[model samples]
Target: MPDTSFPGAWSVDAEGSAPPFEQLRARVLDLVTSGDLPAGFRLPPVRTLAEQLGLAANTVARAYKELEADGIVETHGRGGTLVSAQGDAARRAAQQAAAEYAAKTRSLGITEADALELARTALSLR
Candidate 1:
């Protein structure tokens, strides 16, 4: 379970190919969808989270904006950011499936490019 009191569950791979915002977004989504962050759980402010994660505030802000657009969270002005209640089940299931797939790929020592290509191929088949 993630530490609900802080953004301690999130970490950036400084040498990773993925961008900071993308990593932060994924971490936040995973935490929320996995129920580590329960319904009505509040996220730290963008500046606070950025400071915690050693990222620019703009990067964290972009992640928050994207999350809001995806209905994972909602901002209530002075009330701050809260996790949305509606999409939890669906998001949790999807997150679980993706985690399983990622674990399998990692166990197989799959390269990032190959995994991405596999995902692209799967998408194209639909």
Candidate 2:
């Protein structure tokens, strides 16, 4: 149930090692994964997204382009953009994998304190 009424603003996870674009991509991917935005759901146009985010249109376009190239989205001419059929399942699987990895680390007695420490170190390296 992603609110499609407006451009969603995502908070940057300062501790995460991933770059901003990757983090953005992951969030979008997770949207698909979580069934928040199902297949054929139209995404906001690139320009609108840029305006909403206060980012250069190209920045958002680049992210959209990457997602399109990955078969996660498809253009609909004047009809706008829509999510891919397989993308939902694929993204969900990927998100689950990421969650599993975190679980594995935590299961080894890695505390949240240690997790935050690792994230901070990774961010510093990045």
TM-score of each: 0.66, 0.59
Cα deviation at 111, candidate 2, in Å, is: 22
Question: Count of backbone clashes for each model?
Answer: 0, 0
Error of 2 at 108 (Å): 21
lDDT of 1 at 65: 89
Question: What TM-score does candidate 1 reach?
Answer: 0.66
lDDT by residue (tens digit), candidate 2, 35-54? 77788888878777766666
With a 3 Å backbone cut-off (N, CA, C), the pairs that clash in candidate 1 are none
**Model 1, 1-126: lDDT tens per residue?**
333354455488888777899888778787886777777888888888888789999998898888888888888997888788864754666788778988889899998788879978985652
Model 2 TM-score, 2 decimals: 0.59
Q: Which candidate number would show the highest lDDT if scored against the true structure?
A: 1
Candidate number with greatest TM-score: 1
Error of 2 at 53 (Å): 0.8
lDDT to native, each model:
0.79, 0.71
